[model samples]
Target: MSETTQRILPPTEALICFNLYAASHGFIRLYAPYLERIGLTYPQFLVLLTLRGPEGEGQPQGVGELGALLGMESNTLSPLLKRMQGAGLLTRTRSEEDERRVVIALTEAGRARAEAAAEVPGCIAKDTGLSEEDYHTTLEVLRKLRGQIAGLDGKPATE
Candidate 1:
């Protein structure tokens, strides 16, 4: 076979796709130790964190609203919410206006969990090489990219 016939390496797109997986793995690795101390798995922590507002000040959000924001299915998320409820970390209640819908709220213990999460930045500082500013900028860019991909025009892609 000619030299040109040799197998090519993965294409750039493939590399980018694999990079996302590897980066998520790296993030889990970096975040696990810190979050575990607060009794949260990565998914659970993400659920908790997403419920918060600026500086972790916010009321419990509705589960449908949370699911919509996370782009997750109720089938997948409902069980996790149940687990959180069992663990005394959060609550799922019926919405007053619409009894058919469920609302999710952090309990006192959930609030404690959020408070405990304040240690994450410091742990990340020790674990990851990215400077804080670089980290925040990367977060912004990634969120923007995600929003673009999700077609953020006042409605979710599902609609």
Candidate 2:
């Protein structure tokens, strides 16, 4: 279909939320092949990439902490964590000071996998067909949009 023709979306199809939702799925599809080679799903890769702290530092994060950072629910995240643990990607244990808190630390294998997947961003960027400037601008716009939406709760976005 021509670009101009595709622009004539139905009212329901014209929603920004729907576009964002579709884009998210497109992103997952784009990343899936690369992630598969590394034995990670898109969400699994996200968890590992987040946990792969500065310079491959395996910082221990509590389950709640990870949940908050990822904007995920503990109930949904727990099973994923268990799978990663079983796969030897990370270790999950109760905090010594607070047994109620479950802390997660990336295993060396997981760190290695994260490092290996570092080229993923470059690959995605290259495939996006957007100029570097346009890509960055889009990211900035999206970040601002997210902040503004989040701040609709009457809290300052900077907070």
Candidate 3:
């Protein structure tokens, strides 16, 4: 793909969406080897990254919070969280005040893994064959478009 705009774009919305979906996954695949060394699949890495965010109070985060922040449905999040927990990457517990709520926290092991994996962000950008500045600029524009498409009724996609 050249940096120039395509004279003939995709004819339909489905074509455009499918291309982006495939491209995004391909982009992640470029980082697959690096992420694997840290013991994270893309989704698992995303879950840890979400909970590592600075919540207002700096307290441990809950699964629902991660689910919303990550733009994941509860049903979808359950198995992912369970798998990560089983792998010792996270811990899920019910809040004493609210039994219905399941809080998720990084295990010491998880924290180290997250930190180790953090290096991949820059490395992956470098591997993309795009300069850091151009990469970030493109990411911002795409993020805005994704937000509009996803709609405010649901949470925005994970950063």
- Which candidate number has the best lDDT? 2
lDDT: worst 10-residue window of model 2: 150-159
RMSD of 1: 5.4
lDDT score of model 2? 0.86
| 1 against 2, candidate with superior TM-score | 2
Q: List model 1 lDDT by residue over 49-73, tens digit each.
A: 7776557885778888888977888
Error of 1 at 51 (Å): 2.2
CA shift of 34, model 1, Å: 1.3
Clashing pairs in 3: none
Question: To one decimal, what is the Cα RMSD in angstroms of model 3 from the true structure?
Answer: 5.6
Deviation in angstroms for 11 in model 1?
4.4
lDDT of 3 by residue, 1-159 (tens): 433434355545336677788888898888799888888899888877766654312257877777778878889999998999999988989999999999898888888777776677878877778987888899898889777887755654574
Q: What's every prediction's RMSD, in angstroms?
A: 5.4, 4.8, 5.6
Off by over 4 Å in 3: 1-15, 54-59, 152-159
Candidate 1, which ten residues in sequence have the lowest lDDT sum?
5-14
* Clashes per model (N, Cα, C within 3 A): 0, 0, 0
**After superposition, candidate 2 runs with Cα above 4 Å error:** 1-8, 153-159
